[model samples]
Target: MPKVDAETIVHSIAAETNTPEETVARIYADALDTYRADARVLDYVPLFAARKVRATLRQNSAKPH
Candidate 1:
């Protein structure tokens, strides 16, 4: 199987959370920005960012109005 990348993560989470792709992409970019600000390690940055975005989406989904 082909390896998954950040784009794939964003799309997957967007679909799973029933969010717009643009919104998910924006969120992913924001997550990357946060990591970059901290000078996070290079190799695992994408994975970490994806995990962060996924958690954010999950948390948002779980919140009640």
Candidate 2:
């Protein structure tokens, strides 16, 4: 898989979820940090991080607030 940058991941998640860019950036950073902490396979870091972030966004969107 091709390497992905934080900016690209942030923008992508933002676009896909219709979330604000700034919010996405923050979420992306947090997700990356969270995933990177115990990553055994470096190659899939970005992909995994993106998935986690997407899940969080979906959960947030489903909330009443």
Candidate 3:
């Protein structure tokens, strides 16, 4: 499988979640780094990172502010 591009993932998730690309990019980068820190296999890092970003966005949006 080809390596996933971070920009592409960030853009797609941002659009799909109706979030700013900057926020998504930041969260995605953090999630990617966190996952990469202890990853044994890197193939699914992007997928997992995207999921974490989405879940985080959802949680944030759900919070009372």
Q: Quick one: best TM-score, which candidate?
A: 3
lDDT of 2 by residue, 10-64 (tens): 8888999999989988888888788889988788888888898899999999999
CA-RMSD of model 1: 2.6
The full ranking of all candidates by lDDT, starting with the best, is: 3, 2, 1
lDDT for model 1: 0.83
State every prediction's TM-score relative to the real structure.
0.79, 0.87, 0.92
Ranking by TM-score: 3, 2, 1
Model 1 reaches what TM-score against the true structure? 0.79
Best by lDDT: 3
TM-score, prediction 3: 0.92
In the range 1-65, model 1's lDDT, one tens digit per residue, is 34548778888888888999999999999988888788745666677788898899889889997
Off by over 4 Å in 3: none
Clashes of each: 0, 0, 0
- Residue pairs with clashing backbones, model 2: none
> What's the C-alpha lDDT at position 6 in model 2?
82
lDDT, residue 55, candidate 3: 93
